[model samples]
Target: MIISWWKETKSIKEVFVVFCRVVALLLILIFALVGLVELFVYLGIAQDGFIIQRD
Candidate 1:
């Protein structure tokens, strides 16, 4: 992966494949973080209205 960043790609497809993988991983991380935060709020372990308001 480090080599990809420095090395030239033979085709645009290679660049896009790497780019898509990185994007997918980032999205997964973001959604995981959001899910964990929501779980915390649901459990009352987190402060209400600080992260989200409870009704």
Candidate 2:
């Protein structure tokens, strides 16, 4: 199954499209991580005095 899918993406256009999709997914993941960190800080779960300090 994987081999067939790889073969289908042998064309340059298909490969470029796949690359763009992967980059987009990575960007989304990074944004999500940053958002989560911000949320934790806003909730007082993470603070400047310590790694994590509940108020």
Candidate 3:
């Protein structure tokens, strides 16, 4: 009974680790995309002149 419990606990831990890794990867991807978009905007690659007149 103890051995079975230990195995079950280990399996749960492994699954939790995998889930954390997947979440980390997704966050990294999201940040990278945001950075790229910001870079483009900074370099004027995204701005097509739509004048916002002074209010």
Give the winner by lDDT. 1
> Which ten-residue region of model 3 has the weakest summed lDDT?
46-55
- What's the TM-score of each model vs. the native? 0.71, 0.71, 0.66
lDDT score of residue 41 within candidate 3: 67
Candidate 1 lDDT (Cα, 0 to 1): 0.76
Error of 3 at 11 (Å): 0.5
Residue 6 of model 1 has an lDDT of: 59
Q: Which residue pairs clash within candidate 1?
A: none
Question: What is the C-alpha lDDT profile of model 3 across 1-55, one tens digit per residue?
Answer: 3443544645766767666776899999989877777677678986533232233
Q: Tens digit of lDDT per residue, candidate 2, span 1-55?
A: 3433765776667777877777899999989877787788888897643434346
Off by over 4 Å in 3: 1-10, 48-55
| Model 3 TM-score relative to the real fold | 0.66
Q: After superposition, how far is residue 40 of candidate 1 from its true place, in Å?
A: 0.3
Superior by lDDT: candidate 1 or candidate 3 = 1
Off by over 4 Å in 1: 1-3, 6-8, 49-55
